[model samples]
Structure formats: structure tokens, C-alpha cells
Target: MRKTEKIFEVKDFPYPHVIVKDFLDESTLDLVIDALAGLEYDFKESDLFSYWASIELTDIDHPAINILRDDLGDEVWRKKVAKAFGSKSLSSIDMAAYVYGLGDFLLPHDDQVEERIIAYSLHLTPEITEEMGGSLQIFDVDNNNSKLIDSIIPEYNSLIMFEVSKHSWHQVGEILQDIQRLTVTGWYHG
Candidate 1:
């Protein structure tokens, strides 16, 4: 579906979030993917996660980067997204490219960080599958304890946006296949 035709509604299960399939048109997606392919990623690993990540896209001087920044920064688009998530304000955005290879994974955590009102991911892995893992897993939280609730398969051209709060606990499942699970993820800041 074209982005302009998409109706954003938050789903209650697992947490308040919105999934927009076919989020980008073919031409735009191709440009973005090509831009991402030119980026240099660093193999980042920590106690919580392991993946190859490119530096923030905002500082890059690519045409596709400019397109993304402008689109996400557009006042109307920002308002639409903020309203869907019931956020009062969305003043800025931060984005980076990520590649999760075999055995790569991220542990669960609520994306409760400075000024973050919403967290989002735009999946670019066209050949990824549930059996290959790298799914976005949402957790059910009760009394500070979290349990797996749902696993969203990363589909090409799909965009996932969710409210970022204490209850917004999620993680990236390990990648079982020897393939790259590509994504451009970031947050809308209040």
C-alpha cells in the first residue's frame, strides 16, 4: 500500500503499536536500500545485543538520506504518526542502519530513553522468514517481569512503529540463517 493510503491504528496486543505493510513504494525502497548498501557498518556487540550497525543516517550526505529526513520531518507526517501513538509532540528523529547476521540477537528492554516518544523500524530484508528468526518480539509485562507475547516477522517494505514507555519491552530474536536481516530503525523524540 502507498504510505498516503495507509491508515495508522495502534494494536493493543503485546503493546500499542502500528504495522504498515508495503510502507514504501518500490522506487523509493530501492533507493533507500542502495543508499544503505553504501554505508560502512561496525560490528557492535554488548551484553544486550550483537549486530552490525551504521552510524546515524542523519549525518550522511546521500540523496536517499535527505529524502528520509525530509519525509519523517515533514510536519503533517509527524503529526499523523504522533497522533496514532497518542504522543503529544514529536520534534526530532534519529535513525541508523542495522544488519543482524547468523547468531545475532538483541535482548529485551523497554526503549525508555531521553525524549523518545516512539520507536520505529523499517525492515529491508526481503528474503527473511520466521524460521530464519530475526523477528521482532514483543513481551508481556507484569510486575516488572516480562514474557514472550508475540513475534512479528520482518517483512520487506514493512514499517513497525510503537509507543516507547516502561511497558514497551521488546527484542530481536536470534538469526538462525546465514543471511542479513536488514533494517533502518530509530526513534521519534519529543
Candidate 2:
């Protein structure tokens, strides 16, 4: 089924989250990905904590990016997200495009901030597999003793959104293959 016809699947394991496959139509997804590929990205590496290529979308003027930001900021989508995560104050959206190549990884961290209520990632990598190794790993928050709870593979046109709190600790596993693990990630501020 198309994303328009499918309801978001709610999952409550290590935390409350939702996953939506085929989040955008093929044409739109293609446009977004193409736009992302054309942008200049900066390599970011922070010792053992994080490493990736990223491009901020705040000042970009591309049509596809604009459309995506508008959709994400729309009241309808925000309402759906708010209801799904049981939050009534999801208000603003901030985003950036990321590319995780070989050896790139993000360490476990909770996305808790004063205003951030929801965190989301829209995967745009094509033909990714488990062997590629750039998966989103969620952990059971146990202070300094967190344990792995789940690992979600990066699937093309798939979206994952979760409530941002002290317990929402997660990480991106290192990419073992020489391929791009691209995604649009952001947070909805309360």
C-alpha cells in the first residue's frame, strides 16, 4: 500500500515510537533524494561519539526541501504525530540531511531538550541491507548501563518518529559498507 493509504504503525518497546513505510510517493521521494544528492555536505566527526556527513536545510531554497519542510510543519501531520505520541505541544520542526558512509556512526544519546518533544528520521537510502550495518539502534535506558533493545535497518522512503525524553536513548551503528546511508532527520519542538 502507498503511504497515503497506510496508517502509521505504533510500536511500544524500549519507547513509544511509530514507523511509516513509503512515507512519500515515488516521484516525491526521488525529487527529495536528488535534491539531497546535489547539495554540499560537510563531514563531521567527533572522536568516538559521532561521525557523518550533514547538510543543514534551514537556509536551502530547493523545491523538494521546501515541500518537505512545509509538510513536516503542517498542522495536520503535526496533529497526527502529537496524537500518536500522546503529546499536545508539538509545535516546530527543525531538520537536516545526513549521509553516513563507511565507518560513520553515532553514539547513544537521548534527544531530550527543553523544547524538543519529538525526534524523527526519514530514510532515503536505496537498497540498504542488514549487512550494510547503518542501522538505528535503540537501547533500554538504564542510566549508565543501557542495553540494546532494537535495531531498525535504513529502508528507502521509510520514516521513524519517537517521543523525545530522558529514556529515548538511541544510536546509529557504524556503516561497514562503502555506501551512503542517507536520511532527513529532525525534531519537533514543543
Candidate 3:
């Protein structure tokens, strides 16, 4: 397991965000991926949106869930995130693992739920390319027009965090390949 000191922020976009590389060691990453592979996923799809599969991380006793929760909830880690994103103290973490295969997509929406301060995604997908179409698209909103400002490709052992606000409109692009786009994503609430 690698420590959390290497995390860094990226402020050159629609909103301030943090990107942490090498979030976990090779062995731990493999363990987490294996655990997720064994868990059953609920297919979430609708005309309004599409989510291929998801498994909530509500089982605190599960080893992979425990590891992620512990790291995200750690005081040091929280403080670093808070300072980097200019947010208040984060009080709670709610998360789930998502697997997006071919045709899976999520429409643009701001994650402005009450009490939620920050949103994060720990990318677990490997060998993803720009053409694969499972990118996190951040939008810039102006006069009811939302334009694409950035698109982040999901990379293995990388974490992306952003402030949750009305202008924080984003989407997960449709998957075009047979590969799975895996991510452990959720919000930090105040």
C-alpha cells in the first residue's frame, strides 16, 4: 500500500480538481479488482441514462470496501483533499463500484445533492485509450448551454476528485469497446 502524500491538484479546467496517480500499490490494486470481479452487479439502465453495472460499497466488513473507506476517511487524506479543493471538512464518504461495458453511458448532470461537498472516482480500468469512449467529460455551463471543457480517460490506479456544485455538470461517455470501464466512485459529504 502506498501512502497518500503523492496526490496533486489540477486547477486548469472548468473546476478545480485533484488527480492522484499510483493511488495503490500493484498488489493491492490487483486484490481490489479481484474482489470486485467476484461481487454481483445490478444492471442500471434507462432511457434517460445507462449504467451497465454497479455494486454499492455499503458492506463495511468487506475487505476491499474497508480498505477504500479507511483511506478516503483518513484524517490526513481528508485534510489534503479539502485543502487542495478549497473545501470544508468532509464528514462522510458514500461510494460504489461501477463497471461500464459496451454501450453504457451516463448523461450530463450536476451532482448537487444536499450536504455533498466533493465527488471522486478511482479509475481501475486498464489499457484504456482515447478512442474507447469511456471518459469523464467535464462541462462548462453558460446561459443554459453546457459545453465540453475536458475529458479524462480512466487510467489504472488513478483517482480524480472535484467539488460538487450546480456548475459541476459532467458525464460518462458511452463505452465503445468490449473492455470494462471500472471505477470506484462516490461523494464526500460535509
Q: On residues 67-112, what C-alpha lDDT tens digit does candidate 2 reach at each position?
A: 8887666677887788877787677798998888888899888888
Candidate 2 has which clashing residue pairs, if any?
none
Which candidate leads the pack in TM-score?
1
* Candidate 3 all-Cα RMSD: 1.5
List, residue by residue over 81-106, the lDDT tens digit for candidate 1.
88787778798899999999999999
Superposed model 3: Cα runs more than 4 Å off: none
Q: After superposition, how far is residue 16 of candidate 3 from its true place, in Å?
A: 1.6
User: For model 3, how does the per-residue alpha-carbon lDDT over 1-190 read when each residue is reduced to its tens digit?
Assistant: 5445755645746877767877887777887888888778888888656775555686546786677677776677877788778789887788888888899999899989999898999899888997999999999998698889989888788898888887888999999988889898988889
lDDT of each: 0.87, 0.82, 0.82
Ranking by lDDT: 1, 2, 3
lDDT of 1: 0.87
The alpha-carbon lDDT assigned to residue 165 of candidate 2 equals 82
Error of 1 at 172 (Å): 0.1
Ranking by TM-score: 1, 3, 2
